[model samples]
Target: MLTQLALGVGILAVLVVSGATGPAEVSPLDAGRVILGHLLPGAPWTSDGSLTRLQDQAVWQFRLPRTLLAGLAGAGLALAGALMQAAVRNPLAEPYVLGVSAGAGLGAVAVITLGSAAVAGLPLSGAAFLGALAATAAVALLSRHHGMLAPTRMILTGVALGSLLSALTSYLTLTTEAQNVFSVLFFLLGSVSAASMDQLAIPAVALLAVTLFALARARALNALLAGDETATALGVPVHRLRGQLVVAASLLTGAVVAVSGGIGFVGLVVPHTARILVGADHRRMLPVTVLAGAFFLMAADLLARTVAAPTEIPLGIVTAVVGAPCFLWLIRRGRAARAGMLR
Candidate 1:
């Protein structure tokens, strides 16, 4: 455990240093340094703003808030992934796995396509939240029809819904504009580069509070791993707990999705990685997942900036590229492990 924590710390340090000491064009290290209090009070974005003052305004007022938002998004999404997996007892369950991303993607596209001038500052987040909520609600309603969530049925519904949303997103992007391609692409792929502190503060606080609440409920979640009937015998209210977790996951996910655009795969990858490191015991698993999510997202964001320089790749792309293989391996290994155990 100490070793894993140390390794996580090492990864974070490497990313931080890369951001701080690397070339200005590729690395956001100077930005991170300012954000982390490396520069004095009079410094900031440029010398004229005063290095401290500039750093203060740049880091505190600008960069810190945005990066922090990205962190929150990562933690929230990863945590949501953890919850979804536990709730359904499926390794493949996540916000995106259920088509929430696609739904959110559709909502943002609606705003971008129609309300670009009428709604600014938060139109995208608003749209995305509504979309995500709508998707979650749809799935919830469908799952409750028979008072049971059959995994295959839920998966199929999500896939269908996600396809519809993806088609809508594509249609909007194509018909909208040649000039607006970059903006739409950024939103679709998810970018925290455009975040502002004022925009991030509310959700950051909300997610943290909810995460603490989840930690408080960790024992209950642990009970859930033992199958619903067994869990009920052990005094866990399976249905009620399921509803509570869904709401919590949705709250965290909606908040993060609103801010980060439709970032995908972090949730799927981070919690699985967390489980691998800390085991399935929610007491250790939950906290490790949260921290792991934070570090993983932060590192990914750093790479998003440095990997392609000024052009900047989206964090979602980085996660998908890295996560897909890891996820495949995870499922394969889980099946193998279960097989061995049965034998």
Candidate 2:
């Protein structure tokens, strides 16, 4: 309970800080007042001349939406990573590592380059979702050995397919007009600078639905971790559960990628961080993973915009810079721990 309280407070604090940050120099107190004023009709801040229109616009219109979207994207990607890791029984599996994001990227890029009519009239988000499912299906089929999905095979196949799909996406991007090139590149690398309140619905809904599903099936996920045969013997429907997890993860990856572009590492890093903080039990770990992911991305997005003021770095670049070092440290720590256990 204390831990939950701390996490909740931490998330709120990050949100307020992020909302207050940016080119405009809005103080944290004014930002909070603006947010509260919007939520509460009778708040004195709404009518108070102390709060300027510029401050309100900066906090309510721009920063808040971007911050909230970052949080949603982080939570969604982290949850998806958790699902993929469980499904594949591999620690390295994630939306980006597993080619799911690549697939979604291809779909979205195609729509951008070729237009919606060329891609069956599906909107950007819909196209990305389909592309993710297609990529997932391809990986699953290719990774099967003697009618069973092999963990090593899945990882290798996902990497290969992801590279191939990325190449195709690049080809399409290169062929597009010069004006579209920047949009394509930014989308591929990831950003949330243009975020709006309207853009928040899809990811928010997807994350909520997937989180609920994961929590409900936490027991089955726990059993599956023991191995397929063990899970099967214990009455967990391994095949069905794997399918559900894949679809759930794909949906989440597609949803967030559609909005925030292909921001990597959150899915890969956050779940592991959660497991380290709490034990490997899904029930406890899932909530922590979601909260941690939200905090991680919000912080990353804040750094991305502010690190080089007046010129924003892409969100993906920031995540990679921060996440790579942390990931390497995790690897070394894991190796050292294993060596100690061997003694």
Candidate 3:
């Protein structure tokens, strides 16, 4: 409980730091004042003329939403990743690895290049969500063996399908006007810079609802970890539980990917980090994963913006640099542990 509280505090600290340390460099104190001024009625620190309008705009209108979006995206992705890993029973499973993000990317790319009018008047995000669901369904179908989902096949299928979707996205980009290519690339790489209060709504609500649902089913998740037969024996309804997890994970991934454009690694790494901190118990791990994920992404976004100064790095690149090494270490650690057990 103390650790969870500490993580929550750390996430808030990171959010503040992210909001403050951007290009314009609003001080954390001023950032707090600006936020509190708006959020807390009759608060003493109400954006008095001590800060210029431009500074206020930078902090409140831009950085705050971006930072909040980063947290929400990270938390949602992390929760989705945790659920995916548990459902597939693979430590490495994640939204991107499973083609959900790539599928979402393809939908967003099509909308951007071919125009929304081409997609029967559906909104871009809605198209992206449908694409994500379709990709997940395809992977599930391909990976199922004898009435159960096979982790290895699921991972392989996702990789193959993700590659195919990427190719389609590339083809769409190449055929579009040259001016449209950069935005396409940016979306593919992912960024939260253009985040807005409006964009924050759906993801925030989705995260809350999904987190609550997952928590309610925490015991079922724990049972599944022991294998399908064991889970079935425990009355966990393995197939139904897995299906529900897939749908929940897909919805969460689609909502974030639609807005944030496929930021990777949080879902893959954060859950593992949570397990390391709190052990493998879902009840304990899930909450920690959510907090750790929010903290990780906020910190990543902070580095993404400030590391390059005026030129912001892509969110995906930053996450990859951090996640790749951690993933490799995890693999090595697993190998070493197995060897020790054999010895």
Candidate 4:
């Protein structure tokens, strides 16, 4: 039901965007052919002749995987944000806000800049996963006193670590080759251009599995919102659940970042949008956020591909441009809520 709609909207949005601004487009009929070729792998839908390998590669290799990557990336980031917010009981606990993405970026950047053996030989996947894991470890360590994550301490630690990582990434950019800098900068800008099937499976399956688990046990999450003591009273295994969610979501985010760079704000915006559609209940909110996040990124990725014509924008830039205003609006709304200016 919700799943099908999400899939339909995601696919349709990409198809429309591909037709409008894909790097070498054809006629309306050919657009249909492009989509059909994707749906059927090797369908004969060309106008004058058979679809060329160039065309096939253009549509299949570059565009389609990129689109799929965007949706999964968006969904994974959003879910991570949601879970983090619950785990820490904070509004500003996103991957970027808490420095997980930065940690991952710094780790991968270190490999790219210094660990040439791995960067030149192995795929970025392993580097990225290690980086994210490293960052998560730093956050957990800094926040834990005896054996628990302190919310304020965790956020401060994350911010500090994130700033440090960003500085290193910038320093590397300054010292490295121009082309290498551009490649590194793309990760900072956040993009979906590097997608491939070999890379896509991990995040997609992890996100799908986590989302299902989250949905099925949303009550536990919701109970956490009622405060830790209340959740415990209600039979929610607070520490174990938190551990499960954080590790699961972090792995998912790391997988996405390994491929998609550093897309921002989908996590922040999508959950807010979900709250509008279905109240603030995590059970309902989780699924809605997942679906909404995918849709938002698909639309944003379309803009990334088409809005500037030949000069494709990074998906992160579009999300920031659009999400900044939404962030401001949310901040203002929060002020209004505090002032008793709105219900």
Q: By lDDT, is 2 or 3 better?
A: 2
Local distance difference test, each candidate: 0.73, 0.88, 0.86, 0.75
Query: RMSD (Cα, Å) of candidate 1?
Result: 4.2
**Model 3 lDDT per residue over 1-343, tens place:** 8879999899888767766776686898888777777788777555346766767788888988988999999999999999998888887789989999999999988888999877677777887887898898999898888987777888899999999998999899999999889888888888999999999999999999999999999999999888888999999988878878987998999999998887988888888777766777899989998988888888888888888888988899999897779756765676423422112
Model 2 misplaced stretches (Cα beyond 4 Å): 1-3, 144-150, 330-343
Candidate 2 residue 58 C-alpha distance from true site, Å: 1.3
lDDT for 141 in candidate 3 is 91
Off-target runs (Cα >4 Å) in candidate 3 are 144-152, 326-343
Top lDDT hit: 2
Model 3 accuracy (lDDT, Cα) = 0.86
Per-prediction TM-score to the true structure, in the order listed: 0.83, 0.92, 0.91, 0.87
Model 2 residue 192 lDDT score? 90
Candidate 4 has an lDDT of: 0.75
Arranged by lDDT, best first = 2, 3, 4, 1
TM-score of 1: 0.83
For model 2, residues 6-37, the per-residue Cα lDDT tens digits are 77787789889987897788888888998999
For model 4, what is the alpha-carbon lDDT of residue 202?
A: 84
- TM-score, cand. 2: 0.92
